[model samples]
Target: MEIVFTVLILLLAVAASGVAARLAPFKLPLPLFQIGLGAVLALPLFGLRISFDPELFLLLFIPPLLFSDGWRIPKREFFRLSKPILALALGLVLFTVVGVGYFIHWMIPVISLPAAFALAAVLSPTDAVAVSSIVGKGRLPTTLQHVLEGEALMNDASGLVAFKFAIGAVLSGTFSLMDASLSFVLIAIGGIVVGLAVAWSFGLVRRKIIEWAGDEPGVQVVLLLLIPFAAYIFAEHFGLSGILSAVAAGMLMPYVETAGAESAATRMQGRSILMMLEFVFNGMSFLLLGLQLPGIVGLAHIDAQMAGNVPVWHLFAYIAAITAALIAMRFFWVWFNLRLKSFSSALRGRRSKQRALDVRLISITSLSGVRGAITLAAVMSIPLAMPNGSAFPARDLLIFLATGVILCSLLSGSFFLPWLLKGLQLDGEHQRQRAEEMRARARVSEAAVRGIENAHDKLSTQLDEADQALLTEVSGSLLATYRMRMDAESDSEETHRVANRFKQFERELRLEALRAERQELHRLRAQQEINDETFMSLINQIDMAETWLLGSLSSSN
Candidate 1:
């Protein structure tokens, strides 16, 4: 009952955080509000405390969120920006592990090199979701945002893998560069292979199920939700990188969905359900962070007093130093990559401009490396005892430092990112994307119009006169709608306006019809004219129609 109540309270807090963030007069980040709510719940008055389990948290929360990001990220842009993203995700993670590892060790001699490396490794994975929350949609350049998303996806695996090795070294008191390198390769490749295989197998099974049982949205959505967890577990069972597996599964999901066997209801409901899960899970992550902060700090203070009478302020200083080191290392790396790209372009006789913009972007990227729940989970997983049956060196201080860094990074990102991005003109990329979408829409509409005409002509030849007339009328209506949408994409202002008006009027009428249908269904149910199941089925159809209608209206506008 206590455990159940805690979960219910956390869910409520998650819901309340969303509303509070919206209702707040100031534009504070949603994560801040959630963390604040969590802290309030943890206060002495409320005394809400739940035991933190790193492994459980990672298993429960990380996979789906990462999978969703992989499924939703723009594949084209991700591939285009793959070079920079790999540089940041792979190269920079290792770089930070070494650079920041040594820095932490030097700054605090109490922490062994392996322990310091563990801390730095965990810190290497930035929370792009938190970054997105800090800077609202479309605020950053599209390319930059894509790079960040891609980096976040890949680095979570890389960083955690490094953390694993670091922890192993700490426990075993031995490190081998060659062995670790080979293991990393095998782990990464195996995880990727496992993920792809799992997703593909699941896709095949789902297709068979649909063929056998028909397309039920509820079943399909539940199956969709299981992909990441299955992949993660399967990969981990083989001693591979579960994080990578989750990401790989998510990336493969787009291709799985390309079969076009799913109904409109499945797609709509799946999207809604996935979005709700992302929100709740993300909120829960930050709330957990806030919930752990007070206990971590209090315990650290007690440990500090017992260990060496180290000041609490020294821990804060260490966090600040480590945070600065991370940002500095990241900035330098991004600058070097940008310079290398520029040099390559120059060699190809394509001299670059916008050097100043590159600097600003580098700064933005550095500050955007805000740590979140992953770091907390990783650091908290540090074992209490070593092989010698002694307490792990500076374990409490490590957690304290990690928690402090998470807060610092969040604060810096929240404060600095907006200022750095001020007046940055990314309109060129936005306009290019808009133009490409318009072209695609126009081409697809044209193809659809042609298909409808072909079907009508074939049917007309086979039908009697009255039936042929009905077919012609139905086909003409579809063709007219397609033509209007194509016209809305035209260069001419008058044609676009007229076509948009037609679309708007059509959408309004359809929406009104859907509302009437909904009301009639409710009336039928209230009067017991229809059974509950029948009413629900009919109501769902109406809701799906309205959802599609409104979605199209919003997209068209």
Candidate 2:
């Protein structure tokens, strides 16, 4: 019962935090609001405390979020930016682990090199979710945003794998560079393979089931929700990277959707469910970090004692040093990587127009490397005792430092990112994307118009004169709509504006009619003029129509 209450409270807190974020006077990130609420909940007055279980937390929250990111990320952009993403995710993670590991060891001699490496490894993975929350969607330049998203997706696995190796080294008193490298390759590849296989198998099964039992949205949604968890578990069972498996499953999901095997209802419902889950889970993750902060802080004295009876402020200084070191390392790497890319391009006789180095972009990238829940989870998972039963060295101090770093990073990003991003121009990228979109929309509308005309011509011969007239009229209406869309995508700004205005008027009129229809249905139900089932069916039809109207309106704008 207590456990149940705790879960309920956390869910309520997640909900409240979201509302609070929106209602706050100043515009702050949602994660910051959630973390603040969580911290308040941990106060002595509330007496709310939950034990942090790293394994369970990862299993419960990480997979679906990663999967959703993988599923929705712009695949074209991800592939195009793959070089930079790999450099940051794979190369930077290794660099951070080594660089920060030695820095941590040198700064604080109490923490063993292996344990310090473990800390740095966990810190290497940046939380793109946190970054996204800090900077709203579509605010960052599209290319940079895609690179960051891709980096976040891949680095979670790489960072955690490194952390695993470090922890093993600490426990077993053994280190093997050659074996670990081979294992890393195998683990990463194996996870990707397992994810692809699982996703493909699931897609096949889903198709067969739909054929057998028909497309039921409820059942389809439930099955969709299971894929990430299944991928993670299956990969882990084979000693692979579950994080990558989940991401792989997500990335494969879009292809499954492209099959167009399910009804529109299934797609809509699945999207809604996934969106809600992402919000709630993401909020809970930051909230959990906040809740743990007080308890972690309470142990500062003990950590101070463990660090040779040093003052607690020294721990904070260590955190500041580590955080600064990370940002510096990221800035240096981004600068060097860009410079190297430019040099390679020059050697290859490619004249890139963009500057070789953009300081603003580099600063944004550096600050965007904010750590969040994953670091907390990974550091907390450090084993309490070694194989010989001795306590893990500086365990409390390690957790303290990790928790501090997470807070510091989040704060730093919140404070400085907006300032760095101000007046930054990515107008060229935006204009290119807008032009490409207009072309694509125009092409699609043309195809739709053609399809409708072909269908009408084929059916006209089978119909009598009156029926043929009816078919022609219906087809003409759809063709007009498609033609209007094409007109809206015209190169002429004036022509596009006229078409868009007509679309807006049409949408508004349709929505008004839908609302009236809904009201009539409700009136009939209240007066007992219609049966409940009939009223419900009619209302659902009206609601779906309204939903489509509003969705189209928003998309068009």
Candidate 3:
């Protein structure tokens, strides 16, 4: 009951689930595992009752999560997959909402058309987190992966807007196709403009701060964290889609430098922080859902009679029907799109390997649409009462239905995706991609070696012969290490043999350097040349340098 205690317990649960996931003998999707943990924690013996404030959840979680995802996505790949992304995120979402809305209204007459549409919209956007957790580790075509990710990023905005309009129709008891369409366009455009403006302003300020601060990695990453929340809040304040604002803000970040020490540290630290946040937030989200399961189920049973005499079994049936419809409609839409593309290619008198890839991509994409947190948030955000303060028609049933669909979609996707992957023989171009990576690594190594040589040349002019020889020896060893990596392949025994020797030598040199640095810093402190604060700071820097060096050596090996 105590807030602090409750928060601690939830965090502990998240930590335990994470550890369990890592230690499990077989692969288990994290969301499923976390949700299951929550369900078990909800038992009477645990005395745990988890409740989520849907608005708070959306505001606190969605922006940062979306922004991090957006920042990670390559602009080039996003554009490359734009056509399919649009087809799914925009086109398929619209189709699903309208088509499924009508079907739900017809199938369950107790639910109003607007309410049915709201339900449809809530279920429309596939959670990228869910899809990635389920399918990211498995071998799938990279293009398909990109399309799925891109679609998920964009569709949250589109789906939430559709949900808003549908809720508007329900409350106002009026619907205008043309006005709704116009409003949708305006909201999307305005959200994008606002997001860009906010991000641009923040980026300018960030650059100024970095210029003034002289590239503090900690400060840089802190600033990066604030951009998404600012964009989300600003967009929401203006009655636009905050989700899109966050996405846009993330995508708008300037070209990131990867070569410098400070830049590398910033990138590494930022990635790690984001990943930790993602793990905690995603795990907590599912756990919260599981916590609410008993309550929602209980409510469903209590309100079953009120919901047009629909029994629990009927709710289960509705879930099955809607999920089936969701999957089937996606397949149909994808099939239609592929057919159109093939037709156009034929008319143009062109044939290529991409046609075959398209077939496989269609299958993968159709199956990748697993609903998760966003869907639950939207459904739960619906008000229980209308303007007149009477019960919103079938609100409980709608929640039940949405929750069921989420479970159904997640379960089905997780079960079928692996099997489908096993059946398909994919030419993922593994060899080609590896070769490209090797070439890129080689270029980077050459640049590093050149920089080291220039440093050696400068040092030679300043130091004695013995020191100069030591510098030359160090440079040569480093160069030899990179050269070894350049020609090494993980699969080759000869390469491994050479790599092992180089790695051992490199590790020894690095450890000695680390020891010398520590000794010098401590000696300064002992001689009262540096204060305690300065000594600790220098020691921390040494630690970071040693860690980075070790990491580099390990990766090269």
- Candidate topping TM-score: 2
Q: Candidate 1: how large is its RMSD?
A: 2.1
- Work out the TM-score per prediction: 0.95, 0.97, 0.87
**Residue 149 lDDT in candidate 1:** 95
Model 3 lDDT at residue 512: 97
For each candidate, C-alpha RMSD in Å?
2.1, 1.6, 4.3
Model 2: how far residue 193 lies from native, Å? 0.4
lDDT of 3 by residue, 1-557 (tens): 48788889889999998889789897767788888888888888897975678999998888888888888886887997799899999999999999999999998888899999999999998977787777655377666677788998999999999999999999989999999899888888888887788788877776677667677788878877888888998888989889999988878865432224346668778878888887788888888888878778878775567557877788788889999999989988999988788878888998733545355556667778999889988899999799999988888888888988988898888888877777665555545565677678778877887888899888899999899889889999887877776655445788768876776786788889899999999899999999999998889788888888787675554
- Cα lDDT tens digits for candidate 2, 1-557: 99999889989999998889888899788888988889999999998989889999999999999999999898988998899999999999999999999999998998889999999999999999899888887778888888999999999999999999999999988999999999999999999999999898889889998999999999889999999999999999999999999999999988875289899889989999999999899989989989998998999999999888999998899899999999999999999988887888889999866675778899999999999878888998999998889999999999999989998998899999988888888746777887887799899999999899899989998999999999989998999999999999997899899999989999989999988888888899999999999997888778888998988777666
Model 2 lDDT-worst window of ten: 426-435
Off by over 4 Å in 2: none
- 444 Cα displacement, candidate 1 (Å): 1.9
Instruction: Give the best candidate by lDDT.
Output: 2
Query: Residue 269's C-alpha lDDT in candidate 1?
Result: 84
**lDDT for predicted candidate 2 compared with the true structure:** 0.91
Error of 3 at 112 (Å): 1.2
